[model samples]
Target: MSVNNVRNIYCVGWNYRLHAQELGNTVPESPIIFTKPTHALVEMTGQEIPFPADQGSLHYEAELVLVIGKAYRPGIRVDELVDRMALGLDMTLRDKQNEVKKQGRPWLSCKGFLRSALITKTLPFPGIDNLGKTEFVLQKNNQEVQRGNASLMVFAPQTLVDYIGSRYGLDAGDLIFTGTPVGVGPVNHGDHLALYWGEKQLGECTVQLG
Candidate 1:
């Protein structure tokens, strides 16, 4: 019963150059998407992630959540499209994403929060265009900081669904957190975040403060 309408939420900032030098930004060439509102997707563990006390840091970007099942745009390629894969949680706010890039604004307060993109439950791959060499991971309370694969994504994942459907148009429960690697930081208050792809742990949460 999960995997319902999640509308747009394609995020892929600094695909991973140590998260673009921790935020300084560089290696781009393509996908650098951003967006997160569909009610900020709350509770999606088995269900229940209501943590938000005010916000100061709260970071953790262990993503691999591409779940689109239809609807396309932007010169559709990669053998058309159709998805159903899993794992989510792209929560961030590192000081409101460093004051929205110092000032250039727009990132909706470090990625529209509330429950901040937390999903899973739609697992039916053979689609998602294979996701070029998948193999991701990121743990906290357990150890293992961050691991990478997806061929060190520098804008892959079908080029971020064809450059974000050629400018926002990917429908059918849109979602695509395909980023994160090079150990990101922050995640206090109870911290227990966990995620995996190759070994298939897919979900885990506990960070409470907001």
Candidate 2:
């Protein structure tokens, strides 16, 4: 799938129970959907990444991403429409997000900055049955910082696709970020960030604060 041809970028929030609790938030009964523009996308190719330094507390959110291969149809299963899957980073400006949350404002400013969405190479999706047994991890400077699987998600892939598709609608070329787990932390300059799907290392890159 060509990332450049992506149409919409949908992201789920508070999908993991542990992630919600870690942030002192309650587990939401349903998925919380958000969006990012196409400009936020950046492919992870072992390059030096430059981040906006003025944004306070730049956070790295490692997530499983779904690549929608078919057009939307109500009541469709995620696995039916998603042709591939990948590991991704949904970068956030934590302090700015907190400030907006206090005011009950949209999170676009904090979540939709240029190059905020980072993705790895797309892999043909193993069946959902097989996927349930797999997990993804993120390491900061060679130290494991986050680990998560489908079992701990508050809203699973099925629920997310159904909700977002039925309510807002999804289409071909859309990407859904299935949310992150606990152990989310700020990214700093010179940090070596590595992402993995099970034992398979996806990619790695170094961070540089702009």
Candidate 3:
């Protein structure tokens, strides 16, 4: 299947209250939405991600990813939509992001860069809402770094689905990066990161400093 033309990459920012506190932001009244160009998508298990050299720091965000299987418009009930996913990384340019945020400009510069986003295999399974339990963890160099469960989310997956749907029409091939939990930090050159769901390996990749 041609993975190009990724319709949209919907991202939730600071959905975890602790993550917000770390970044010095309060919990949002609604889901914070952002977009990454389709070109940014890369398979973490097979590709090398270029670390931003000019930026002061490149951060790793471990998130639960939802891959949409069908088209959806705004206002659709979260229970009615089906999402396939596991967990993936949402890499970011922290210095660049802070600069842009200070300028009150859109986060495009911080979020949209070639190979800036990564995903594991698109495992098709039950929709996210149907999953009774959701857990996520990230390890770097075999060291546990970040841990979070779906229960910590300020808004559930259903709420996220419905909120974004009301504003943008979600279609097949689109992916959603739910907000990350605390423990986000920088990744150094040659750092190996592994993502896991329970006992299964979701994916892994190495970082090359640019």
Maximum-lDDT candidate: 2
Model 1 CA lDDT for position 144: 82
Task: Score residue 142 of candidate 3 by CA lDDT.
Answer: 95
User: Pairing residues by index, what is the TM-score of model 1?
Assistant: 0.32
In the range 90-150, model 2's lDDT, one tens digit per residue, is 9999999999999999999999998899999899988777887888999999999999897
* Model 1 steric clash pairs: none
Q: Write the per-residue lDDT of candidate 1 for residues 42-91, one digit (tens) a residue.
A: 54464335556576677777776777777886677644565567767678
**Candidate 3 versus the native: TM-score?**
0.92
Candidate that scores best on TM-score:
2
lDDT comparison, 2 vs 3, better candidate: 2
TM-score of each: 0.32, 0.97, 0.92
Tens digits of lDDT, candidate 3, 31-140: 89998888888777744667677777889999888777677766565445554675777889899999999999998877887777788766655555445465678999
Which stretches in model 1 have alpha-carbon errors above 4 Å?
A: 1-9, 12-32, 35-56, 60-64, 67-80, 96-98, 105-122, 125-163, 168-175, 178-186, 194-201, 205-210
**Location of the lowest summed lDDT over 10 successive residues in candidate 1:** 42-51
Backbone clashes in model 2, listed as residue pairs: none
